[model samples]
Target: MVFADGTERPCGGLLVPVTLHQRTGLAAQLGAALAAPTPLTAEGLATPKMPGETSVRGLFVAGDATGQMPSVANVIASGSTTASAIVGRLTGAT
Candidate 1:
């Protein structure tokens, strides 16, 4: 981490220097962050918005960052649902 002054902050963690990172590395692992005020709308008279589909194609998110319930259960459910969706898409499952 760099402060405004250009000094590097200590990136210390329990196992940061080894396998198994310090904390949840969703952002670092995903390499992208999707944010929108609400589900994206299509430009038309009546368009359906595919839930969980992010502005970035092939990339999606859920839970707090996705403006959904921030509860632990919600987070788990969202992740599971998104994962399942991705798998279905890959496997061409209806």
Candidate 2:
């Protein structure tokens, strides 16, 4: 395994399927650090506001950045939703 300190380790006979989950990544840590209103979804994923926004104004979140399921569809949806919100605000459309 390679670490952040540029250290590596060698292992043999590694026959395991490891699935990366959101709870084990930096998203949760960042959200907590920023004191954002991240709520756990029914699927156990930590998600920000439904419109892909955070408690702090102008601070938006989406997809994996918000501890959501790591999937292409989720990312696209989150991004689109967030982007629309931002555009609406910028264009003064409510």
Best by TM-score: 2
Question: What local distance difference test score does each model get?
Answer: 0.50, 0.57
Clashing pairs in 1: none
RMSD of 2: 10.2
TM-score of each: 0.44, 0.48
Residues 1-94, candidate 2: write the lDDT tens digits: 7889999998775766434434453434444323333343322233345465565555566666555555799989889988888887679874
Residue-level lDDT tens digits of model 1 in 8-32: 8787654332221113545435554
In candidate 1 the C-alpha lDDT for residue 63 amounts to 51
Please name the candidate that would achieve the greatest lDDT relative to the true structure.
2
Clash count for candidate 1 is 0
Kindly give the stretch of ten consecutive residues in candidate 1 with the minimal lDDT sum.
40-49
